[model samples]
Target: MRHAHTVEQVRAAEAELAGQPLMDRAVAGLAATCARLLRERRGRVYGSRVLVLAGSGDNGGDALFAGAALARRGAAVSAVLLSPEKAHRAALAALRATGGQVTTDQNVGLADFARADLILDGIVGIGGRSGLRPAAAPYATAPRTGLLVAVDLPSGVDADTGEVAGAALRADLTVTFGTHKPGLLIDPGAGHAGPVQLVPIGLRPPAAPVQALQHADLAALLPRPGAESDKYRRGVLGVRAGSERYPGAAQLVVAGALHGGAGAVRYLGRPGAEVVRRHPEVLLGDGRVQAWVVGPGSGEATVEALDATLAAEVPVLVDADGLTELARRGPGALAGRTAPTLLTPHTGEAARLLGGAATAERCAAARLRTARELADRYGATVLLKGSTTVVARPDGTARVNPTGTSWLATAGSGDVLAGLAGALLAAGLDPFDAASAAAYLHGLAGRLAAAGGNRLPFGSVHSTVGDRGEAPVTARQVAAALPAAWRNATAPQGGSQQDAAGLGD
Candidate 1:
């Protein structure tokens, strides 16, 4: 698991190491990474043109020290101080001692930014909540040939929420220290962050509010049948989805449930014949089930299905039209439920659930906040699906899904996800674990289907199909790839295939 600490948490942890050389450790790692990237881009670090965009904070100090280190190693390093008067005195003197050039001219900075082999973006620290200052805004749109590496985080992105308020420096790679920030894991801040590399400074903080699960984490959480396991013992998943108007939603949901790790799938809805025709093994009409999946193309029948599902003592997952009905009825309908309730909604549905001036655009911009608010208000586990799928628990803990492709933005993808999560719930995982595992597997399946096979290594960090030269895929194809994704997640880590960073393109 990759833990993402908030700015306040990072500060508290850093305070514990006040007497130590934290800045030195950070600079060493930054300089080493820059050297490695320089060597990879060109032939060597020596004689490479490096530019540092220095702000008034510790981030600027770190960049200047790193630039001085590069200058010592024969790299031509230049520092453009955005806040010349407030720059770190020690760091500035150190750079000057190393024969590094310093300038406060915006024109000189832009020129250096254009032609430098590498640009270190330390113009803003994690504390910065808004967009870039006017002096440094030009770098946001300036054309550059070399790689732009962010020191801790890209300037102009909210460290806690991943909301890019205005023009933010888009980095080719972000070298973060201590631990990951929530912004680097979620979009549109994630979109600006190309690739992230964590540089540990030995600051141990409290439990992280945000986390991303890796292959091993999922492998441990995934349920597997035992030797003497019967169909009932494994777990039964009850699905109430689709209507005559939108029968395809039922088909997709059932497909996802069947492939999911459930022992049996009992489907109840208007599209029973169609479902049976597609999947003969599906049991028509609902018997006793460990969990129930309601919604997903439910149309006019959503209210009835939701009431019936809610009446059951078993765990219930609400999505799609069911989510709309739940939003209309408010959280009162789920007030007396003894069983767990998992609410899955895309940005639009989430906005409706939130109500009161909440729009899809606002929900998308502040995904973490939106999911947390919904979870708290509804008193249930909320899975807000989007470019970065966030699973938020009512207790304030959350997990950001790091696996997925743009291809998952298909029509019935959410239905497939709802069914898969319901199956996990039936398999006896808690709401948080069920939702997190389902998102991970669903994302991997989408990647597999988009690639047309397991052409890319299982659990690859490339988040998009375009990252690996793949094609578009349908929701049906995504469901079909579930088994392969399951096997990959359960595969031994010692094997040739393994997952690296959970967050990526």
Candidate 2:
């Protein structure tokens, strides 16, 4: 798992570190990274033009010290001091001793900034909140001729929430010290941060409040059927999805379930015939099943199926149309459900469930808060899907999925996720693990499908809208790529990825 520490956690860890200066350690790492980037961009660091956008505190100190190191290495380094009077005195003196020039004039700074080979952004640190000050705001919209690198995080981004209250500098890369912040791994702030590289400073942080599941973590959580396991022993997933008007949803949902390691998939909806036609392997008319998934693309007829699924006393996953019905009926609809229940909703659906206070805009902006509130309000595991998929439990803890691309925002993707998650629940994983693991696989599948059945360089890959060309994916294609994605997750390091189809234990 990739753990993300909060600002408070990072500060607490810094307080516990023994004799070493945190700023010095951070500056050393920052300088090294800057040197490497300079080499890559300008062929050599000795004659490269470097500019530092320094502000008031430790962030500016880190930039100044790093500039001093670069200046000593023969780079033409200059510091644009946003607050010259309030700058770190020791760091400023060190930079001056190393032949680095500093100026407080914004016009002169921007002129030097335009011709520099690299720009080091140390305008704000994690503690500095509520976006950029007026003096620092211009850099957020400045022309990007040089390679921009953020010190710890991009200025104007909320380190704890990943929200950008105002204009923020968009870095080509960010070198963070000690640990990854919550903002670096999430969206909005993550978008500003670009790619991040962590530099260890020996600060042992406490248990992280936010974490993203990695391949090995998903491998451990995935259910494996034993040698003696039969169809019923493995598990059966009952899917109540699609109607006469939307038969394709049934096919997509079943496609996700078929490749999800479920022993059997039983269709229980208006489009049962359509589902069987598309997938001959699927069993029609559910008998005994381990878990039930309702209602993607469901019409008015789905209400009966929802009641029947809930009445069966098995784990139930509610999605799409089912969510709308649940919102209309309120929390009382789930009062009699003794078994585990999972609710999957997008931002708009979440707003409906949360009533008037939680609008689509509000939920989209505050994804973590919305997920937690929805989970607590409905007393179920809630998976709020978006750019960053968050799986929140009733107990207030949550897991954020980091594998997804914006390409997964295509139509019928949620239905696919709902089916996949239901299969995991049937396979005996608890609500939390089932939801999280399923989201992990679903996201991986989306990424794989988006990349055209090849491995993605996730560390360097930017947003789906940028870089990658027009690669449209159907829901069926995403399902078809699941086997490959599964193998990629479970395969040992340095070993070849085996065909995931027919390989489930």
Candidate 3:
């Protein structure tokens, strides 16, 4: 994973760098790099004139300096001073010297803001808290003219808390200085920053981190089975899910697991062994497994089945009915596991698991805290799935899966996810990837499933949205669509994306 520095860590690095006289030149050099990016993309930069929304501090300084560099490249760059006399004097002066002017007149500024090629937000940084000052407040969510490049972070985002204050500007890109701040990594704040561009400013060694993940870096850490692998060697997954009342749960979970790349999946509980009747490939009565998935559609009687699954010497994925049992057991049962355990609880289950914690607090902080507190209590990885999925480990460095579409709130979907995740663990992927990839693909599957399915996340992917969409998506249809999802995630570049018809759009 890419190492991320917290706000304090970046500040210490800045202090050390700023202590050296050469650091000033380095600051200019970094500014020059941003200027170069602007210069090379000038037409796009100005076909969009750069509107620099300058605030009171160094964030504004960076923007004004960037404006100066943009002006030098023939792009019309103007700064709208929010703090008036309190603006960064040196950078403002430098911008003025380079023919980049500041305008305080509201009408004229608003007009320019409406038709600009790009707007550079210098309104806030790591030093700033959430909430907008009165003067610049209106622009927070107003219709923007073009792509926005935030200087450090968008205005009104708490640099430390990752919470948005009263109003916040949403940027297309944020060019962060020194190193990443906590706000640039965590959500509600991270979401506002959009994709980030980390620019080095000769910063020093790291400190306590906030958040980070590197695709290639983490990809390397994921376990892959070799050709010598066997069913037992490949890792076995035990699934104690579904019942006579809800047999599809078992089948879908099995479907998800089979494709999840597991060595073998063991069946337990009622209709589960009978699931082997149809999917006879699965062995009944778990001998041993690397991972266990229980509780999907187990309903009230799932307690015993869940208990048996939890007793294994393998990682466990607790979902649905299993989660309900886990809740009644309190957080202590997880501490007793002989193997690594993972909880795939949704918000309501999480609330039941977390007890009295406020819904917002749990939604905001539970993911990070769950892995720690629960891991410390139960020694397991906590993969809390929701609108904002957070996967935390017993070890630090919590990762938030960044890819999501609002299309995954469907019913019975969690069964597929539990199967997929358990399958990955059985297949030898680290618990982190097992959980995260399952979530990512779950969301992707939802997007594919609902493209023409009436735009409902849980309903079906079988609507007439596309004039001539190829096929309607059923459970089988969604199952068939997963290969493309896997391909997109594994593709080297931004691979050819398919439209609703499952054809290249």
Candidate 4:
């Protein structure tokens, strides 16, 4: 799994490494990465034009030192000091000694930047708040055909929250020191960062609040049946979804549940005929179940079904219409439940559940905070779905899903996701793990369905549909790809033997 540390956590690690020249080590790594980028972008670094937009902090010092290294290696390097008076003296002198050009003129810098093959953005750092300063704004605003590489992180992004307040310099590549920042992994800020390269300076932080699951992690958590396992032993999931008006929801939900590894699905709703017609494997009525999935096109019958599910003393996954009913009844309604509860809500549903100050806009803007607040308020795990799905537990810990694609915003997608999560709940995963794992797998399924291939992790050599040229996906296609997505998730970390050895056609 990939972990992201907040700014405060990074500072604590930096404090531990105070005796070491962390800055020098970071600069050396940065210089090496820049050199490699230059070689890849062009043919070589010897004759390439490099420009360092240096500010007045440690970030600028790192950039200047890197520029000096490149200049010594015969690359024509130039440093435009945003704060010339306050720029690191030693770094400036070293660059000058290596025959690197230094200037404070914005016009000259812009001209050089426009013609340069590579630009190192040290105009701002992780500690910086808001957007680019007036002097540095022009560089960010300028048209760029050359590759832009950021030192540490892309400027103008929230290092802790991943929110971009204003104009930010988007980088083609970012070489971050010590550990990965939260901004580099989350969206908005993640969108600004192209491919990130971690330069380890031997700094270790505490356990991260946010993490992204990988293949091996999912494989370890997934439930599998043994020789002694029967249908009931594997687990039966009860799905209370759909209505007379929306029978399609029932079929979709059952599809997700069956493919999600539930031994059997007991569906209870007015649309039983339509569900059975589509999936004969689903049982028409519920007698006993390991877990229950409530709401998703439930119409007016949601309150009754939710109450029945709540009284069972088993895990329950509440979504869509059920979220509205839960909101109307408030936290008091769920207070009696001894079993785990998972609440899945889109921004609008989350806003309604939160009420008053928590508008849909606010929930979308501050997703992490909203999910945590909802989880605390209802004493349940909150899986807030959006461009970035955040799964937050009642204890305030959260996991951010990075596997999703924009094409997942389709009709009945949430119904499929809800059913899949309920199956995981029945299979014995905790509310937190079930919700997080479901989101992770659902996202991968969506990407695979839409792209018609495996969607590799970020920064991998394999490209997305946009690069390969594919079309959009429907909800059914996403459900159909569930097994493939599961296999990909459960695959060995080193990759398949056929793929690695190129033994397959």
Candidate that scores best on lDDT = 1
By TM-score, the better pick of 2 and 3 is: 2
Ranking by TM-score: 1, 2, 4, 3
- Per-residue lDDT tens digits of candidate 4, residues 360-413? 987886777788899999999999998778899988888877666777888989
- CA lDDT of each prediction against the hidden true structure: 0.90, 0.83, 0.67, 0.83
Report the lDDT of model 1 for residue 12.
100
Kindly list the per-residue Cα lDDT of model 1 for residues 1-505, writing each as its tens digit: 8899999999999999889989988999999999999999998999999999999979899999999999999999999999998898899999999999999998999999999999999989899985888888899999999999999999988888899988899988898999999999888888887778888898999999999888888988999899999878878999999999999999988889889888889999998999999999889885879999999999989989999999999999999999999999998989999999999999999999999999999999999999999999999999999999999999989999988888888999988998899889999999999999999999989888887886455546447436665678899999999998888777785223546543431
Can you give the lDDT of residue 95 in candidate 2? 93
Can you tell me which runs of candidate 2 are displaced by over 4 Å? 454-463, 494-505
Tell me the lDDT of candidate 2: 0.83
Candidate 3 lDDT over residue span 147-182, tens digit each: 677777778887765666578888766777656666
List ranges where model 4 is wrong by over 4 Å: 453-467, 493-505
Give candidate 4's TM-score: 0.92
Which pairs of residues clash in candidate 4, taking residues 3 or more apart in a chain or in different chains?
none
Query: Candidate 2: deviation at residue 178, Å?
Result: 1.5
CA lDDT of 180 in candidate 3?
Answer: 65
Per-residue accuracy of model 2 over 1-505 as CA lDDT, tens digit each: 6677889999889888756788878898999999999989888899889999999888899999999999999999999999888899999999999889999999888888788999999899989884899998988887759999999899998888777888888888888888888787666777788777788888899888777676677899988878999878878999988998888888888888888888899997787877888899899885989999988988876789788877878899999999999999898888877899999999999999999777988887778778889999899999999887888898877788766667778898888898889888999999899999988888778777877865754331224444364267878878887777787788785112221111110
RMSD of 4: 3.6
What TM-score against the true fold does each predicted structure earn? 0.97, 0.93, 0.82, 0.92
